[model samples]
Target: MATATFHQSIVSFASPSSTISQCGFKIDSSLSFTSKKINFCKIKAMASVSYNNTLLSPSKTIPDNTLKKPNEAALILIRHGESLWNEKNLFTGCVDVPLTEKGVEEAIEAGKRISNIPVDVIFTSSLIRAQMTAMLAMIQHRRKKVPIILHDESEQAKTWSQVFSDETKNQSIPVIPAWQLNERMYGELQGLNKQETAERYGKQQVHEWRRSYDIPPPKGESLEMCAERAVAYFQDNIEPKLAAGKNVMIAAHGNSLRSIIMYLDKLTCQEVISLELSTGIPLLYIFKEGKFMKRGSPVGPTEAGVYAYTKRLAQYRQKLEEDSEVICS
Candidate 1:
């Protein structure tokens, strides 16, 4: 394997940029020197000091232009990049397929698109393709936080991987893999080529099987049935985190993501049938006050110059950029 070298630097308060002046020498960033490398680096601010004693604490005052909002959370949903079955135009529902090399690149690009967003937790399906997408995208995160899978199946596993230090826990993102997030099981059509199936069964029949929300194909789970489990799992496992003001990133399959999107956007069955999500594109939503507000898709810096960031997202991005520039300078 080829190796790359990275340089990490800390930004002092005396830097030219005044935005990070109050942070002391807390800002951090890194740059790598290599041919085949992601040229991005994550900058993190050091922990702030707080006094516990009332007598010793300074007068509590809110910043004049602070953009931080309480009880507001971010949700980023991404369908896994193209799988081998996808390349072959096969019915890949519930099948364990790995990503193609192109898929790998797509995943990385997807990560870069949302790299500035903070991700507190990650969720993915048990299938390797979704799992791979999650891991690869995280590699490009601007936070530089390591993502560790939580294998709490057994007491031994949980105990062995447990973190002993609070600081270490703060620097890592927990990954949870669940089968409930898996793709709709295609049943008898699992390994069949989509074109061949359509030809054999007639396009109308195939269309009904593929696009009809309530119809299941030959012992398979319909999109409605799939949504029942997928949405429930999301509500039970993922919703509470957002409710608690934590940003979450879910790397899941096409149908599963579509189902979740349907719920978030309040899309009608007829409307959802026409919705098509491209491989590796991310959809963002701001969850606040028990409601989800769609932030649409983030257009990466290259393609659109500016992401259609909500007020909150724009502030968040600006804060990170100032901190990053300080550290890199």
Candidate 2:
């Protein structure tokens, strides 16, 4: 009878949900338990034990190709070769100006310098000065076969064309224009000569208007505003291409390019205001992991000719200031 009862208990335990109560057995101190029945209970208890254990482990890592090396991607920021307004020291604002004769030559030289490097993409402003410089540079670099993509708000019908006409060509170069990269709007100051403006307003006031970050000139955008717009566009559009190992170049105006550089270099408003970008010179930037690693200029620290000309202009301004001081005295 005892053996049979033990066997029944074992069978009950083997069934699903194998509850201890369902085994139809109870321990009593008054009654002496058989050794076999006791052994069966031990085995069943061992089988019913639940071990609650869990482990936390780190997730698999994704390789960051963008962070691998600075040489993986680059950005070349070139101010549009000199324009007619540039020579006259006039406020160009958003005005479309053609490049001067010397400006065209400068663009060709810039092309020669970067011809060896494989430029995967090019970006320029909608203005003619910038567009022409980009066109001239690409042609000189023997990459004119690449399609030029114009970014006019009105022109929405064009489809993406092949970078090169030759199907056999492996090289792919895309030239795109963006309005966000346009020159700073000079507002009421547009078309006025810098010297004449200084004479009309005080020299210190003109300097502050030109160099201050937050102070906008009569309905015009300030340097800080330019930086905000330019950086936003760069983060949304340009940064991804750069991360993907594309060598990008931007042909734009002085102020627009300056806005970009200020962001890339992490410069303060004051530092950005002090920066002076010469016409037609290419400023190269190396980026890694979405950060600026290094920057270089195709031309030396300063173009001697342009520097001398700027110094002469400064002297002319000083002379006017001295005359004003005497009158005030």
Candidate 3:
């Protein structure tokens, strides 16, 4: 409910100035109390005093000039918005699914949320949904002149922009497609509906498949496996950005993001499984000296906005059900 209210207020800030001016608030309070009772007339009497104080204040604003823009040692992790598989409650695994119409809208809104932030580099998986979300976000930043730089295996660190300058006039923003960043491979569970999988494999087993760190689904990867690749890639590719003082954004899947979060937050495998990532929401991280310094809360339309969107989705689902019932009748 609080999130819903927040989302509603956030959505109203359509203008850049309004969005930047929005203030955050908090309340604090303290209390102390004591009591003494005497029984019978002969008993001695005691006195006690108590004091309480409370302070509530709006979040302090850091002047744009005074506030240090996040250093180049920053990373934004965003789960690609809902895909067709997500709508069907199917296991997407490593399968590439296109974003549904609503998913596209979510990505657009997410893009608008961080349009003003200076993002120097963008990272994405080979999957289309993640790639599309990254592209939409980049477009929102009005970086149309930046050309995508593709990294290939044979050349390893080949800078595609330099090579393709003659082919395309636009200055390319380097786009590095890496397999290490791909979503957890679901293996045999990839195409199965969640309910069906639960029924066939039993709920507990299915839950383990979905939530366990070391337990791979059939022939698929465990969270640990995903993290291994993700961390490796992060160190090899993403670490350089931070060292160079560049802000980076990574668009990927829930599992992949979880992998990175696990490393950054120092969460155990079990804990990582419990972490939730909302689609299209950005998780910003700041690093210093090859270590995490801080992480920014997801900045997006308020919970109210997400609730509104969810409600609309529910209504659409209900209408489809009703239509199907009518046809059956």
Candidate 4:
């Protein structure tokens, strides 16, 4: 084995082939460094992920390429970046809102984290914030394929938007927007300042409406009511794609995503009540053999767990690394 150590090293990796029109960098843009600026005799050791290839239990890991089966695919769930209403501390249920500047940056950063991972299709709520988050995140993907929305409202819309060339179709990804994935409706509370509403309605009442599993705000959808539509759409529309070995990414609202996650993890009603998700952070899962296994989130491509445990993922990373070297050269 070649012995190499990097007290500090810098390198950049890019992959154009994986993207449409050969416009992509399969590696994080931050990885680029001037080779002349650093020296390495050899690369001796690499950090191993726990349970994981390193035989350490730092993190619960996928066992021995348990995801090597062709049926296995990656499922990623991300809450939409912060919206304008979020910045204002207002209740933003199904109302269509846009992302704030910080929200846009969050989405871009999120894209960098999963740049190396494969994403064949995307799903987002019908709201503009969720769709914007999805589009912004894809802009950072090492795979630079355009994510075009599928128009299913009318048959003519679909027919009119169809790509005639198979190659163009192959290079593009379909983004499906579903109203079922929208945030839990806040009814009369929409646009109301959360703090003011809490003050007026009493903190306890607001808490029940927000955190209680089945309680609803005046004419609004409760967590349970939201889940009824969200989870049903997931099981009906999303799971089938996973079964077909397609990598799927979903950009949605907090409550809707929480509901979908609750279904995936089989959480109890009480348990789901306590679940909370931060905006713009992605949670990963492996879908195989009609089962879903949470993989936690990958913070970056350099993270050991990102490429370890799954042989196929490791191989994909290896290929990306090779392509990256060629790019830097």
Candidate 5:
């Protein structure tokens, strides 16, 4: 196996003088993509990714500058792109519509905005639109790690799909599809046209059904009802993963995400009603010290604010860029 060792980190986030002692992570000094083994494998258990997208080992070295926040983890939330029903102005609810062509593009675009971010695990709703969005977005990630849908319905299914190779498993990201994260059930209004429904039910009544925090549409769920389940799932499933230092990404519906955002941002019922999220945009949050701090949406990878918000992200970006340059050199 071909290999190279660096006594010093040739790639630095800001300075050219970074040495091995200053960098806690293991990085092979020069690139030989054809190398049978890579430095990424050395820290695979801790970094949770391979060299396809990141230059660092799975156990990413934490820079001393951000040493105070060792438990910091990234949290990304993206609503699914426009679905076919969305294009038709229909009440999709939990109907399971696929994305429109425009929706596909939106997903790709959202992926670019957060392409630099490292995601350890992904969670998507049990609906196809959300699943599609998550899959498409990952295609744009710098790390070419595969996102595998974990099937645990039966022991046989789980055993049959196992990747026996340690390197292969470390390079894969687990995608968990959960019914609890599905969009709020619209009940009787699931397939109805939004405009027609409003006219049939009177504008005032329809407005209340759609926007009121506690009111339901016919037999459908209210925003409050959605929150009861969505937020509970967030706390029980997603939050603990972040608290454990795992970077996470969630792709779901507008209402489901809105409900979670309500909990994260501590939005009032009235305030959440006024909050708006465009389809396919990714919102970034930092989880540290048992609290979530909103970092807002990243416009693109070129946006300095997003990458520079933390030293780890900057180092991650710099390392990958250097890897690309070494290959081309």
Candidate 6:
């Protein structure tokens, strides 16, 4: 077999001093094919005025009661676990599908990976697969806080689902389901097998259909079109929570996530073309002082420097391990 070599694209910065903290999340970084370093751009800092896209202007003042401790701001993004379509090598797109057995296991494992992190809010696409991933991952959270889906569909629904006691509300995380966070519409390819599609269309054509930034697949959404909605939702809904210093976890599909990542990392059309994500893996970001610092996922209990940013994560990890040992014993 011929050995295949791969290259890691590095995002370029004007200078080393240009930390993500100083610049708004809209990074001025560009991908360099020859570079081996991994570069990340933060989401453009929130502004008083909305950008040309669907972003709405943030409130000028946060209520005194709304201010959380600065260190509490964190963000976690996870692509949902494998679905039946994924197991069958089909393009899932926006079709509402359930997880496969392997996907259920993946969701459980994903929960363990971020068991120590604090999650004050949850966001997911209004699809079963994404919803299942978020709920299953929360199973191992050290906080042991239950996740309650918020039902704000109507005044009646809201009133019916309201918790009478404040204590109960405080103990649970709100999981908000939104269609804007759903996966890219895969159009006519929704149930088709990937191999067959590639066979029908040439491999290169299929690759372009799958990976190109602006080219949509046979009436499906292109990455650019997906970003118009996904990133907009993040700016409008998710970022406000982070701006208020709340830790948020978003469970969504691959293309939707890639769209948000493109905004956060400031990937250009060419750069985002090759971006890919693995299912059930959570990526972390630290939000403080109105900026986001990308912290790659924690792969193990003792991964050095991973826990240094948050004291709560380290303490929770220790407690989780002790609890696990007790269960085994």
Best by TM-score: 6
lDDT of 1 at 299: 65
lDDT of 4 by residue, 80-186 (tens): 87788888888888777788898899888888887766788899988888899898888888768889999887999989988898889877889999988888776
TM-score of decoy 1: 0.72
RMSD of 5: 19.5
Instruction: Please identify model 5 stretches exceeding 4 Å from their true place.
Output: 1-69, 307-329
The residue-by-residue lDDT of candidate 1 on 137-217, one tens digit each, is: 999987788988998768999999889989999789999988778877766787788888889999999888777776777
The candidates, ranked best first by lDDT, are: 5, 6, 4, 1, 3, 2
Weakest 10 consecutive residues of candidate 4 by summed lDDT = 14-23
- TM-score rank order: 6, 5, 4, 1, 2, 3
lDDT, candidates in the order shown: 0.65, 0.57, 0.58, 0.66, 0.67, 0.67
| Superior by lDDT: candidate 2 or candidate 5 | 5
Q: Write candidate 5's Cα lDDT for 189-274 as tens digits.
A: 77788888879989898778777776766656677766666776786788767766678999988888877876665454555566
Worst 10-residue lDDT window, candidate 6:
13-22
lDDT per residue as tens, model 3, 41-99: 11101100100010112113231322124332456777887788887888886777788
Off by over 4 Å in 3: 1-72, 142-171, 298-329
Model 5: pairs clashing at backbone N, Cα or C within 3 Å: 47-58, 47-59, 53-143
TM-score of decoy 4: 0.73
List of clashing residue pairs for candidate 6: 24-44, 24-45, 25-42, 25-43, 25-44, 25-45, 26-44
- Report the C-alpha displacement of residue 278, candidate 6, in angstroms: 0.6
lDDT of 2 by residue, 1-329 (tens): 22122112111110000001111112231012211121212322232231001001211333232322432566777877778887778877677778889889878877766554446678887687888888787776644445356444444434443234566343445677776677766656777877788899988987887777666666566665555556656766776666666677889877777777655544445445666666676766665443454334534323333113244334433443343222100
Candidate 4 global CA lDDT score: 0.66
What is the TM-score (0 to 1) of candidate 2? 0.66
